[model samples]
Target: MSLDDIRGIPTIELPYETIPVTEASAGIQRILSLAYMLVWMQSENLITAQLFGRSPARQLIFLMDETEAHLHPRWQRSILPAILTVLKELELIIDIQLFITTHSPLVLASVEPLFDQEKDKLFLFELNDNQVTLNEITWAKQGDVIGWLTSEVFGLKQARSQEAEQAIEAAQAWMRKDDMNQFPENLRTKEKIHQQLLKLLPGHDPFFPRWIVRMEADD
Candidate 1:
């Protein structure tokens, strides 16, 4: 009921309750969740054993859903590698498998530097033409988080806000048109399109030439 009662490790006492980790943030709570899950899986009780200090199996598989949940960008980057280290500790005598679903670009960018193609693969689930499809892609190193956001795994055309995304799509649609002067939303003039693109995309964007020049050339 008191910190001294639990070997000075702290505890949550009822009514006049005091949680072990007072004022802890969600990121810390995420770590505790993982630690507790490991403890329960191996010992069924938190007090019986220290969770990750020793190997619990020769071969093990871990499937994590949204491992980046509640973690900051820095933690998101380091989480997968840290989990792998723990799993490797558990799998001292054999190989291990990790399947994790994540939507964080930081998470992908973090793994980009350390992922082994021989031991790892990236599965991308894309919704296209109202149907969902899965593809296995060769692991690629996207050194920048923005690059990871635009990568096929993330399926983003632009690593910008929703308005920017809409402008880029509109520009693309305009470029695909047979007539350069035709603008569906009164973006007919070259100046209008140029200004819109400048607002939506950075100067060095790869699509700049295609949308700006090619569209003008057709006129």
Candidate 2:
């Protein structure tokens, strides 16, 4: 009915369809939330009308920063698909150009079926050698979200925590060492390797079985 409690912006009274209801959401229940709602609600109406009308500059471009931000997993998965579906609903088949940046593996995995190598381009943003860089990723179906997290795009070796990855890397480094044939020249060297392995790796880790086999084989 009235407006108040705006932190930074000027608040205004706006009308909503205030029909009698048994329940109301926490968001729409408050004046502050209502003010925020009117802003975005009007923004979507105004921006679309201004940009996508029948004019010579008819090409539409959307630059979405962190497209998966504030979205639930299900919504993150459906976002790109929903956009394409909306395009199909339109009378004119306008070529919509979307440049979206996201860190969500779910967002990346969701588009596997719809990604066209010829039409859609994928780039992996990275910081290598203290410089920001973009690398073109060759399109490949990872089949699952976990695979996408571990793929070159995400640059995760095992989709694990920092400590776990370090342990795995240490184990791998041991395997790659040329001293596999001469793993231990003495009891001291053998004990050092044993302590290092146990310190870095958990006994129940899947890497253990193969590691034990390989160590015994070396001995």
Candidate 3:
């Protein structure tokens, strides 16, 4: 079935059923996941609208586990925002509660924005072994989610900066060794230096196409 058809389905069972997209089409799968999430949010909105006239005291609790499993980083980034938007939209209509467990950094980054200073409606707990520790994220007082993320509690900025710097250094080294024959004789020594750098590097870029473009440009 097409992605549009999959999005129309109310519920999707995990593990037992195939996600309907292959690893080769990761970008498409990410888009499909987002569409499915939005559709689910709309369904919840409709259900809450109907309950408003009747049993307004009825509580709805949604439990999402490993929400970022099949999603790419780009799509994973959307999960928290979509959830927060749904919660805010349904706040008055229904008493909505959510319990989500995720290992994705993107998911955590998305949720860091929803904390409120006046109300303890949002809580974040980190689990280690059998113990759970709650993190006192002060985003509500910070005014911006990005600001709070860069703060000591989150340290997202430092982590991202380090990762980016390593990536650029690796990319530069890769471009230098991409084609030894294409370069002039005088530049051949640079290729040996690049090979040494590659051995010293800690990580690999499996997405070769993005780096391939830079290799071609160097010629």
Ranking of models by lDDT: 1, 2, 3
Best by TM-score: 1
Tens digits of per-residue lDDT for model 2 on 1-219?
Answer: 226733443333337644322234332234234345534544565576678873333455656677666667887798767656655543163446778889988888888888888889999888889999988889998988879988888878887676556555555556676344333332124445566567766778777788788778888
Weakest 10 consecutive residues, lDDT, candidate 2? 19-28
What ordering of candidates by TM-score runs from best to worst?
1, 2, 3
lDDT at 98, model 1: 83
Q: Which stretches of candidate 1 lie over 4 Å from their true place?
A: 1-23, 43-57, 93-95, 127-133, 166-186, 194-219
Please report, in order, the local distance difference test score of every candidate based on alpha carbons. 0.72, 0.65, 0.57
Worst 10 residues of 3 by lDDT: 181-190
In lDDT terms, which candidate is top? 1
Question: lDDT tens string, model 3, 3-79?
Answer: 65555433333566645355335545664665677567657767776878543344667677777776777778786
Tens-place lDDT per residue, model 1, 16-110, is 55666544567776777787786566554323334656544544477888889889888998998888777766565455678889999888877
List RMSD in Å for every model shown.
Answer: 7.1, 8.2, 12.6
